[model samples]
Target: MLKARVITAIFLLIGFLAALFLLSPLGWTLLATVVAMLAAWEWGGLMRLVGIQRIAVALLLGVPCTTLMLAQPEALGLSGSLDKGAALSLAWWFLLPALGFWTLLVPLWLVRRFPLSGTAFGLLTGAVVLLPTWLALVLLRHLGPWALLGIMALVWIADIAAYFTGRAFGRRKLAPQISPGKTWEGAYGAVAGVLIYGLAVYFLSGSALALPLLLLIPTLLVLTAVSIIGDLFESLLKRQAGIKDSSQLLPGHGGILDRIDSLTSTLPLVTLLWLVL
Candidate 1:
């Protein structure tokens, strides 16, 4: 399993780096669209949409992304929208609200453990989570490959830290029903890891973004929590759907949705911050 995971990660990294460095603006849009298509398919599974229904849901979500990529409309408001696509313009509408949804609303929903199992609501949920993330990737890449990579690193650092910390010191369950493996200690470790990562970023390139070092900390802390919310969210969906790993699509990563679940929340919120700050 570990070997498979390592190999997959190597390939994923190679592909990501290739896309990051080699793709033109439109190429990146297409790349993001492909990701959206696969993610939408997995999201359909989470919604319990099978057969034609699965493809339908995936297409339903992916088509909008495709339109946004092709149209590149100026009305939606995006920095890099001029030549690439209107992904952010359309994305912001969803992702802006998503920022609030993941930050404040999701935590509450998790605590309550609402039985959100209806198909209509499930499709809506997929829209809320997947669309913005797809756009966020596009927007981040537009900002600069390093920008995307740096922000993404925060999540990676947090995830690794949380894993080790949780295994070493985890006691209390973070979400017993949704995910028994997660713990409060793990959550703290993730935050601590993000803080340190943020500091490193600040020292290295924070000035380039024009965000102050101190100011960046609070936002990173908030996003740190948001990243955790993203993970538990998919876990919740999987529990409700009665599935183990989203799908066996990847050798070790499980599925596209499973791999990018945290990204589904974190990236959009970060992109939102990028627009405002």
Candidate 2:
């Protein structure tokens, strides 16, 4: 597992750098859409939409919907004058729906006794997971390579901090019912790591951000919290479906959804928050 994880990490790092630096905005958007589609496929399995017909339905609904919602900035009220920096900021703020999924869907799932068993439910869940992340990637490219690098750095810092903190001092579980390994200590570490990363971005970049550190601190906190929830949500879905990982697509990572579960939630929230504040 560790070897698989290392190999996967190396591949992801290389792929991320290439996508961020080398791709045009349209290229990035297309790549993000493809990734989201793969995630949607994993989600379909988790939701028990496994047959060819069900998977086809998911792809049919997901592809066009994601493209329309995430790729077309004009539909989302973004103007042509918006530079990469402004677009990235806006994208960070547009994550409200993804946040709403946790706020609304988790309770609904529990109250309804986790009624996410059907094909329709799976498709709905896939939409919720894929659309925001797709938009985030599209918007990241729109903001230019540096913005993409900055976002990836924040997520990487949080993930690394969480892993170390959880391993060293995770006495209290954060979500024992969903993900037994996660803990509050790890959560705090993740938030701190991202905040430190954001501070570095503030000093290093010439983006003319107002109250940059202040904005980044709260934003990073929110993103981290959202990221944890996203992970747990996927775990819960897998538990309900009686599976271990989302898929075997990424060897150690299980699947693309497993790899990007946190970003799926964080990116959209960051986008939306950037837009509003």
Best by lDDT: 1
TM-score of each: 0.92, 0.83
- Local distance difference test scores for all models: 0.81, 0.70
**Whole-structure CA lDDT of model 1:** 0.81
User: How does model 1 score by TM-score?
Assistant: 0.92
> Candidate 1's residue-wise lDDT over 16-134, tens digit each?
99999888777887778888888888888887878998888877887887676456535222334443334445655877889878978899989998866788888887788888888
lDDT of 2 by residue, 72-184 (tens): 55543243434545454544444565677865765466445464766666676677677777776676455568766667667767888998999998999887877788899
Model 1: clashing residue pairs? 72-86
The worst-scoring run of ten residues by lDDT in candidate 1 lies at: 75-84
Q: Which candidate has the highest TM-score of all? A: 1
